[model samples]
Target chain A: MTSNLRFVFYPGCLVLQRMPQYELATKRLLAALGIGLQDMPQASCCGAPVVESFSDEWVYLAAYNLALAERLGLDVLTVCGSCTNSLKRARLALRDPEVREDVNRRLAALGLSVEGRAEVKHLLQVLMEHRAALKESVTAPLRLKVALTYPCQVFRPGDVAAFDDPLQPQSMHELVALTGAEIVETGVEHECCGSTLYTSNQPLALSAGRRKLEASRGADVLVDSCGNCHWLLERMQRAIWAGEPHKRLPVLFMPQLLGLALGLAPDELGVNSRVVALLGRDAHD
Target chain B: MIENCTHCGLCREVCPAEKLGGRTITSLLSGGDEYSAWLCCCCQLCQEVCPEGVDIHQVMMCERRREPAPDPHRRSFENVLRYGYAFPITEDINAMRSAHGLDPVELISAEQVRLLLHCL
Candidate 1:
């Protein structure tokens, strides 16, 4: 593992406010993999999809966070798919001279400017980049069957993310495999989890989540990388599953599973006993 | 970019919103109602599969700016304006972070955020 691999961690608003376990698990896993994480000072939202809808000035907010990362002189690493997409889009948009100039002028008011120096990488990209270190770090191979819920924004709009196949994503499958877990093909891995849609239409969003959960019934546990996906698929499972608690599948963030494989305690990675019990055996066994 | 839509309906075929019986890129391209723009989950699949490089996400965003934003989106924008985050962060967040053994985040003040985003 390259001990010098460091990133300014950008735990987007969703994770910061709603998903502490995801944050804890990600930080724990990255540290064990020899990756250093530095918190961005005075960082705020990347003005996620919500801001993009009402104003072109969303670029300003995204650039604002990027400029903050630039101040630290390190690439930004994010755990949320929406933040990854919003920040990457803003970086691309900043390449336009006029947009860059305007954004700089606005940022200058806060003593910040974005030169497009910092790159934004999602957690999946970071894990895939350190596959060798990850494979070596796995002390307890998770033998459970796992189904993946791919974060839509993390891989799609191909040109921007540009890391994996947008339609048929294999990076996650390959990364999860390094943990010695069998990857189950649920057929709905690429579908939207509908977290964004929940804002406008609750029933439709839950239905989308329900579809994925139903499709993954064959698997022992469902794994997701994005906070939005976890929120709908895991937190809202009761509402989506509706009175069939036994039918509900255990959901774990990508790093939680990886942390377990790395010989970290389930409690340290914020893995609840339910998820541990679903492992069907001691994590080390 | 919307003009480049060949109306191949490939975006419609891949759109989860459309599959779930909501109007989406194909409907918006055909002059569908304003609500069509709000129905997207921001999955970017429609943009990914567009044969003509139509940037359907941008097209939907343009349409969204024209309509009244949904309550959740409106509240999110307000939260950004008020707290520099899409969700409110109170002092207790630091307590939560401490429990998780993570460092407390130093949030930018709303005054600074307001000055930076005054253009909005």
Candidate 2:
């Protein structure tokens, strides 16, 4: 397959499994717009977050994934912002003559070494830049108003992979607008919704997620391009209701939200999950 | 010898460890009291983003190393962290990954879940 027609898509673990709807929706939307997503079959975790925290030894694993992409001769497209940040940081660090020499020495032990630069685009960045291309085929208009959220890792200072203002990014707003919807600015636009903390500290994650959900309670649907943010808010909304009929809120992944507006059926695009359930009937379905 | 009062809170505005309404970095550095500086996350983003480019995480870590981490619920949290079974494992079978030799199934930690995020 030629790289020109299809981008090498990297749907990091969360989007692939926990929220398969994201991948399904994204595939449908991209297909409608004549864009092909060549899933990077060999891609793996950018070594997760702790890989960056606990040891540089784990950094090599992510580096291996990056080098694999390099061999393919196309820049990688990562769905998770944290994965993008980690890969970008590793690439940046290894580019430094001193850092490269040091890291390469360790990598040599495993028979792997990353070469020069490669573009690591977040899913939002891809959508933002290509909105013009994708906007032409807007078949259905979205009526649901959305609250846009940009989590912390999407644009951290260390990796510096920001395409817009890291403090108050607008990619989500812009993309949602493509669906002909009003976008509201929530206070915790880039705040950590405590996704990683969810497994370790459910209380902490729920507390933080509640704060965000409460803030976006006004919107028709809370739209997040980040999987971590979407999952956290959705889970918290479930906890808040807990066997109650009124247990619901407007939480959705960016891809599914777009799919709804595009008039795709829920089953055709896999948007029938709880997230879209909050937005009322599958407008796309 | 008091290092002359060349009073410039430039050290305060530029330091990463000092919170928005917290103590100045110079005071912490000079007074040998590090508790005030131990809160830095050490990402060094603050220092690079700062105009003065102060190495605040380093300073904060230096002070933090001097004392024990102040975790009030350390004992309770330690139990949760050590067991890696903070959440109650579900009794009902929904979805699980099991090999030949395994100790039942349960959602363990963020680390394991994280792997599937990309792999899946």
Candidate 3:
């Protein structure tokens, strides 16, 4: 996509703290491509599904986040799926005259306000929109086959945040294609990786992950657009390998993979971390 | 919805919460498995990540909340207020924070907490 200066980048909770590489790579990648990701000085959690479960009022907490983006005078680009869905849904919901009034009043009490002005765009859309820039930026075309494992949270259902067909997602694949890496189109690509549940139920996490890996058949690696999927798959693989036939399919944040394709070194992009090892030590793997 | 469960348990295989508890969702749904709910971290990872799309976290949380309050975990903040301290103690949060030059910056006061609870 033709992007230039001035865009507010919403680094969801996972990206800001746990997955620093995602923020690092996104900031650099966007900068290299003439996209400016302005940070909100007073940003907090968007309050994902868990908080949303408790109360509809929790949604204003998210609207508060979008309001921060709106105050910045830029469209908000989020890298997390649930964050993307939550922000987009909150934006649409807050526009209701009644909800907007309620949200703004509650937030104003907290030094926040929901104006419902920021547009929500996921990183996937921006990357795909500027395919030509990404293509020209590739220092080395990665030739390994990688599965695009988009967990359900990352893919929004019809209506809010529904930019493409969630059932059969091809945006990440299309973006990967520009890097010259072979994309393994797998059915389980849309399956949930059990995300953070691995911390609670190890065996089920491993089983779910093994099912996904089994579906991939012979893919060289898996590229994830969400941090939770990347962490869950890698953690589950460890759980699975503890007893049975070890499956070591590597999972990567698509941004990290792009960094590698753009001639970034291993340690430079945090590829030396354990998860990156699953994708293999070399470009050919 | 409590007494209406089909004894045929699809929730066991499909539930991440049940898997962690080593029990079936059928049992949890039947007002049992309080121990598992006590162990729940409130991650909601189970509900959102379910292949079958069952709301396991809600089922577990409901079961947990009904029981006489259990010590799930946490020290400071409201986790201590509700769950008590169950999990192992790491270093004190303030110590680690100060070490990182990121000492705790309290946004709301204890009175605010009381006001919120009282308002509720």
In the range B1-120, model 2's lDDT, one tens digit per residue, is 123323344444443234323343345544534334323322234434444545443454445435443352232223223322212223221243122111222323344323322222
**How accurate locally is residue A284 in candidate 1, as Cα lDDT from 0 to 100?**
36
User: For candidate 2, what is the total of clashing residue pairs?
Assistant: 8
Provide the DockQ value for model 2. 0.08
**Each candidate's DockQ:** 0.83, 0.08, 0.11
Which candidate's DockQ is highest? 1
RMSD of each: 1.9, 8.1, 6.9
Please estimate how well model 1 matches the true structure, expressed as its whole-model Cα lDDT. Answer: 0.86
Error of 1 at A114 (Å): 1.4
Q: Which candidate, 1 or 3, would have the higher TM-score against the true structure?
A: 1
At residue A242, give the lDDT of candidate 3.
Answer: 64
- Tens digits of per-residue lDDT, candidate 3, A212-279, equal 77777678777888766766666457666666545677667787788777766655455545544544
TM-scores of the candidates in the order shown: 0.96, 0.70, 0.71
lDDT of each: 0.86, 0.56, 0.59
Worst 10 residues of 1 chain A by lDDT: A276-285
Which of the two, 1 or 3, has more DockQ? 1
By TM-score, the best candidate is 1
lDDT of 1 by residue, A114-186 (tens): 9888999999999999999999988988888999999988887788998798888888899889889888898
What ranking emerges by DockQ with the best candidate at the front? 1, 3, 2
